[model samples]
Target chain A: MTARIATITSGKGGVGKTTATANLGVALASAGFRVVCIDGDIGLRNLDVVMGLENRIVYDLVDIIEGRCKLRQALIKDKRLSDLYLIPAAQTRDKTAVSPQDMIRVVKDLKPDFDWVLIDSPAGIERGFRNAVAPADLVLIVTNPEVSAVRDADRIIGLVEAEEKGPPKLIVNRVKPEMVKRGDMLSTGDILDVLAIELIGVVPEDEIVTVATNQGSPAALDPRSRAGKAFREIARRMNGEDVPFESLESKDGFFGRISRMVRPGGA
Target chain B: MNSGLAVKGVGESLLIHVPAGPWDEVLASLLQTVVDGGEFFHGAKLGLQLEDRELGAADLGRLRDQLAERGVNLWAVLATAQGTRSAAADLGLALDMGRPSQRAMQPDEPIETELPGDAAVLVRRTLRSGHHVHFAGHVVVLGDVNPGAEIIAGGDVIVWGRLRGVVHAGAGGDQDSVVCALDLAPTQLRIAGQIAVSPERRGAAQPEMARLRDGQLVAEKWIDEHRR
Candidate 1:
């Protein structure tokens, strides 16, 4: 199957780029698609740990690029999902160990085999960012609902446009809906107003996500996770399905009740 | 034979024109000139103009490192070749000398002649954050200018949509230059030497024009002649 390569990048660090990549890979693979997630952060490798495949990595992306290992030997298959795999970044080597051309060459070889290739990009618009974007057929920008994060997302959108990659979709992660209702946090509308891009999904802040991540299982695998459900919807949208956006405000506990009482109709 | 290299001062930096020659010879002569120039080359910003000379990222990176070792900063690279331009850009080098007219034209010196037709750039798309547009003449944008973007024009500036970015009109000291926008709320606005931050809006946005009045920048509602 011809795979569509999607790179997840956020200009700022600690905005759930790795978490989204890992979760999306699990969500898609659970749908019976062959998926491979590559960690593009070479020096600070974390996708393997997040994906719970760190101990299984015999070879990595740098080794495959440098001809030290075959592509099959480097791919560490997921323990839970048979068709899901990961090509972890080399913890010892830095970003300079792999070039943009090398990334393009590696992605080219994987295109015909997997149904989806999700690349987790490093923060900043440096060599690592360029390398991740160089091979992307689609780009997904993840951001938190804050001024600095939105500002950085705008910059990344401009750079992605400059690269001539089709308009990148947006995923607003770690959104505190209760805070948004209280006017303490920026709403999804406020973010979309500035970013002016297509919204794929809005994930509410969930403590289960932290538990799931640390347990080496993505939130998408947990049936009761709010964020997991949001990720599943994102995966469906990625597969060309028409899933309507779920309202984050309706689920907020006391704020939801008060808002509904004030408006008379569901927010 | 001539070494085929030329260097001249431009504002705060030196513009070096690299002549069409063998890559090795060109680089060797460039290093030799820097060495021969002594203290003049040290701590100086160099803008290398390579007209149609193709160079890869490795070559440009090496040259940048070599220049850095000599205490010379490689600020910009002006090239006509696509390969060379992309290489320079990938290396985080400025592609052109931005807003040269800002320094060249003196505010006190008045223009003595009127051109046949004044020049202006018409941008048809939104200018997002980190995007900068600098022109020597008027600039007319048909889309929104988001915060963190900037426009420095030597003449008047006009925006058909929201104007929320930093903008400078009459940058060359033409106090007569004005800025007009449908939604005239920029992060900061400047005309000639005067600067102002947009005040908080009390209601809906409306078309407005800003210009220097009695040595102070002021914004007035844009009223059509026929409607007035």
Candidate 2:
């Protein structure tokens, strides 16, 4: 099957682009799709660590691009999932080592074998970001529910538009539902109003995400994890599944307590 | 492809040798094309070489207004038409067959004018985050100025959309300059050398104008009476 290259980018740093890419890669692979996750953040690679495949990486993206290693050798198969693979970025080389056209050719070569090619874009509107988005059939802009993150997302979206890769879908991550209810944080609606883009997913704030990240096992592996489930739903949506957005606003302690108290049984 | 009607740069002004053609259509199309490319002709000094179309005051005045709407000034009209020359003189615009005098060209020179002032450039696109516009005159944007975007104007700024970006009106130390937008909330606003953070919007946003008042910046609902 032909692969759909999806690039996940955020202009601001530390907003969970790597985590999202790792989780989405795991989710899609578990669903019986051949997925390849590429860390587009040259000199600052982290997707290999996030996916727990850093030790297995004998060759990297730069090696393959430079003809030092075969494409097959550069790809490290996932320990947990056989179908999932990662072409880790070269930590020694900087963003200048790879160009936009190089990324296009690389992704095009991978298109024949994989079902989905997910690229984790480096933070910033520089050469690295352009390289990540150069071959994207779809672009997912991830942001937190803060004003700063949303503002940076807006800027990235504008640049994406200028590149004619417009109207990219948005995934609002690390949303604190209680804070939103208390009017202390921007709600999903408030963020969407300002950005004016299609919503693909909204992953609520969960402590499991932090624990999973530290363990190098993305939260998408755990069935009990809410954020993991949200990411799986995003993956499904990407695969052309019509999953309604989970009602994240009411699932916090406030509404959970009310629902449990009102309907004691299965209701 | 009309080789006779040469349009080229002469100093700062564009010298257009208007060849014999349908003057109305050619002039209108020329203006439309220039305006379509936003800010291409803003505040530009323009001269026309009208061979012998003895145009009246009404025709010249209409053309002048058209240029004015696009932020271009028709400074001179070189014409063999005596009526056209007279009309240019009536409008206080220059009229001659050859070059502009030193006095006429002085205002157009960057070295002569220490600062470009008052004349604003209007932009009709969203200034997304990280986009920047640095102009020696005023800046007027017809779209949203998202965060991370910046505008440094020598005079004033006006935006028709949300203004959440950094805007420095009167950037060259003209403290009397103001910034007005549909939403007057900016990440930071600077008039001359003073900087101010927009206070939280208590109520719904109305069309607001921000200016330095009483040594502190103030934003009030835009009213026509207070526009001056």
Instruction: Please give the CA lDDT of all the candidate structures.
Output: 0.88, 0.85
Lowest lDDT sum, 10 consecutive residues, model 1 chain B, at B97-106
Report model 2's TM-score to 2 decimal places.
0.71
Clashing pairs in 1: none
Q: Which residue pairs collide, candidate 2?
A: B130-B148
Question: Which portions of model 2 miss their true places by more than 4 Å?
Answer: A251-267, B1-120, B172-177, B192-195, B212-216, B223-228
lDDT of 2 by residue, A155-179 (tens): 9999998889867998999988779
lDDT (10s digit) by residue, model 1, range A166-260: 99998999988779878899877778767778777788899999998898899999999999998988999888886766555556543344333
- Error (Å) of candidate 2 at residue B13 is 9.1
Models 1 onward score TM values of 0.73, 0.71
Candidate 1 residue lDDT tens string, B146-205: 888899999999999889999999999999999999999999999999999999997988
Error of 1 at A125 (Å): 0.3
Q: What is the lDDT of residue A35 in candidate 1?
A: 97
